[model samples]
Target: MLDYALLAALAAVLRTGSFDRAAQQLHVTPSAVSQRVKLLEERLGTVLVVRGQPCTATPAGLRLCQHVEQVSLLESELRDSLPALAPAAAPATLRIAVNADSLATWFVGAMAAAPGCLFDLVIDDQDHSAEWLRKGEVLAAVTASAAPVGGCSSHALGSLRYIATASPDYLRRHFPGGVTAQALAAAPCLTFNRKDRLQANWLQAVLGTVPSPPTHWMPSTHAFVDAALAGLGWGMNPEHLVAGHLRAGRLVELMPGRPFDVPLHWQQSRIASATLAALTRAVLQAGRAALRPAAAA
Candidate 1:
């Protein structure tokens, strides 16, 4: 029989990424947690974790942690429903991984709508955030990849439209034909970082050449938007984030009707917890309302 304390320790170790941090969180000594995990691994006859600077879970460890999380959530729900339990501390928190563009645009609203739940958000590029889910760092993620990670399920959230945008003054000075490859290559460009290839990808798709402009890397999504609004250079702007600016003429959509669509997906561990279920429903509801309609036949 598996001990709940050991299971809790396993979950904590995975969550904190280190034995020392898990010990601090659990108010127990690291040695004690280590013993508990060793005992648990012996009983299960499987290697549960990879111990290093930042601890990682083995496949078995991932499964065990997911089970522990589901059990913890269920217990919390039961305690919350009881008369004297003081609401059970919000189901031990729901950790999420999301792309920066979504975080800058619609994700904050979805999070705001989640009452009585605590969230730990890990933000990364849409294409890469699902890696966190695979590593068992987050319970769910908003990702660009349609393929689910191991032991996870996924749903399409709809496409996010991005327009190549610039301030009108920047357009007048640099982009005469709105943004041909030749113009983009010569103009200064703004990007989130070196990893941000949205501009390069768009240019290649439209004009069969990559833009090798003088680049500015503003890593923060909000700051990137602000820099473009300040006419720093042309950047790919999510339609939702720039809608008001475009309408108010603070920013101009250089490509006008031409837009690129990146498909978004919601990926989550296949665990049955009311908290996760509720969060999934809320995110899907918001996605339906906020995202563009699916591609037509």
Candidate 2:
């Protein structure tokens, strides 16, 4: 039989990132939390958490955490249907992976639409977000993958449009000749991170070849627009973010009339649960409303 109390202790430590914080949440002594975690680890015969300044879960630990969360959500649903079974429990948290661009633009509206639940957001590139679901780390993800991850349902969320944006001054300085592949090679561009392929994808779409451009790694989605406006570097800015600036001539496209659109999808576990269903509904509604239709984009 599983000792849910010990499992709860483990989940609490992983979520709160420390025994003391877990103790506070569970209203138990810190030592009691530690003991429970240790007992659970011994029972499982594997190290679950990597203890550090802020604790992190191992792969096995992450799967367990996901299980705990799913069970909690299921129990919450049960209580909702059977009032007599209801007990006072903290609002269940839904851990999901979403791209930073979506979060800055439209994901929050979906989050707000889903009530009675807390959120633990894992920000990653849309192309890679579905990996979280595959790894059993997240209950749902907003991803660029059209194919569903194993045991997950996939829904189309339309396309997020991106424009290769630069300040007029930067464009004048870097692309005086034109947006040729050779010129693009010498120009400095903003990159979200190593995983970011928006700039490269845009380059390929326009130039038909990827060039080794000098890059400025700016991870924040908003910062990408800010850097483009400040003449720091050109980047593939989300069209929604820089549309006003585009109209005002503060930011200009590397090539006018050519925009890149990434198709996005929502993927979630196939497990039968009302919370997941509610979240999926909100996500589809918000995403469809915010993103451009792929054909139109």
Candidate 3:
């Protein structure tokens, strides 16, 4: 049998990001929670969690946590097969990582359609969200790369196309003579975060060089669009998100028919569970509907 208590303690610490919070959740003293994790580490003869303001798991810790989560999900499924043993109030929750653009656009429909299962959604850049899969922090992720991580599978979900867009007022003020290299160099640009390269990519494609423009780093996808709309800076807005704005003349495209397409893939643990299968189905359906169709993947 697995060391359930030790594993639970470690998981709680990772989830809550502090031993004290984990203790409260686990209904143990803070010292007790810390001791349990220490004992597990000693027995395993490896460093697990790196203690800090927000506790983070090391690679060894990540593997253990992933194993525990997978086992829990499988066990939940087994319980479901036995109606007498299944707890009605305890539906298994899927922890997933997704890009901010997808979350802001098409992903919510999938969540809404999945009625029974709960979700813990972690938003990361599309390019980096797969790291969460490799680390086992999430059961599934919407990622940019199609290369499957070990112990995981990837499915091409389609592509989210982004257009360089700005408010009409901002465009009038910033680019009076259409998009020029000099105009772009002087214009303030909006970025989702440091990890976001869509803005830079668009700039490079347009100007033949990526200029270091004044940047407003807004991390949220919806907020990034809102910031652009509020005339803060030009940004690459996902087509689905800016469609309404474009139709209403609220936003104008700087580059028409030259959208920057970032193909997306659904990556998930190579585990058999009804919940995961269902989530994959819903996401695939919703993504196909929202984004441009790609070659079968």
Candidate 4:
């Protein structure tokens, strides 16, 4: 009973997060897309979208959009197999959400392997990137959470090891032996932007008190690593990213024997698109090669 054209338009609007971008992609005026959505909502007797600066789908809208995306993907697969039925162009854009750290490290290789697909990368913390998937902002995500978002599937990528690290000069100038509760309170620490509290959390776990180190806010993951290497302050760095620096003697691991492990997951929508499926498999394969094994039971 639903109009396929209107459903496709709705899916486009939800995917792009704005009327203007969806219209541009669809090669129609923004007004025309808006009219189509309005008509569709009227026919369905539901408020399907929350119109704002960055648009969001209502719960009903999300369900409908998911259905539409699945159908679209299925159709694309069928068309791909039947050359006579194939569309002129394959869907070129794939929207994905990834944490800043993963994006800085192993994710680039997976992306490089995806030669023909255009990517829209949404960067957020691993802990929260799945929310973008739930809202239909992205079709897939690299997240810390194991729980899959609704209508999505998840795979355990592997553990991302974090080492408590600082520059040799910082260690010499501050907590010379090793970091302790009292020493950490007085030291300067580097943080990856405002939302990063891993350093503080580690302090709390070890000492039962949060460190009140004078903080330097370096937002970029790469920059945060660089700042730590430059002896800005003590912080947790992803082991892989800091491996070279540690070997080169540019940085030193503060706690050589103990390391924190953060598990990573790859979450993707349940849509049956061959391209998405292939991409997911490739990422998982790459992750298994790159990451540490699961902790023993």
- Measured by TM-score, the strongest candidate is 2
Give per-residue CA lDDT, model 3, range 1-297, as digits (tens): 879899989988987889999999878999999899999999999989999999998888978877777777777888778968846434666889999889888999998876677787888999999999887788999999999989888989899989888999999999999888888889999988889999898878767899888899888888878988999999998888898999999999986777888899999887888889888999999998998887553
Ranked by lDDT, the better of candidates 1 and 2 is 2
Q: Give one digit per residue, the lDDT tens place, for model 4 in 195-227.
A: 676787677666788858898887788888888
TM-score, ranked from best to worst: 2, 3, 4, 1
Clashes of 3: 0
Candidate scoring better on lDDT of 1 and 3:
3
Global CA lDDT computed for model 1: 0.83
Better model by TM-score: candidate 1 vs candidate 4: 4
Give the winner by lDDT: 1 or 4: 1
Q: What is the C-alpha RMSD of each candidate to the true structure, in Å?
A: 4.1, 1.4, 2.6, 3.6
Which prediction has more favorable lDDT, 3 or 4?
Answer: 3
Candidate 2 to truth, TM: 0.97
Q: Candidate 4: global Cα-lDDT?
A: 0.82
Query: 124-206 in candidate 2: lDDT tens per residue?
Result: 99989988889988999999998999999899899999889999999999998988888899999999999999999988888
By lDDT: ranked, best first: 2, 3, 1, 4
Candidate 4 — which residues are off by over 4 angstroms?
7-24, 29-31, 37-70, 86-92, 114-116, 134-137, 147-152, 176-178, 193-197, 204-209
Highest lDDT scorer? 2
Q: Of the pair 2 and 3, which is ahead by lDDT?
A: 2
Candidate scoring better on lDDT of 2 and 4: 2
Extract clashing residue pairs from model 4: none
TM-score of each: 0.77, 0.97, 0.88, 0.78
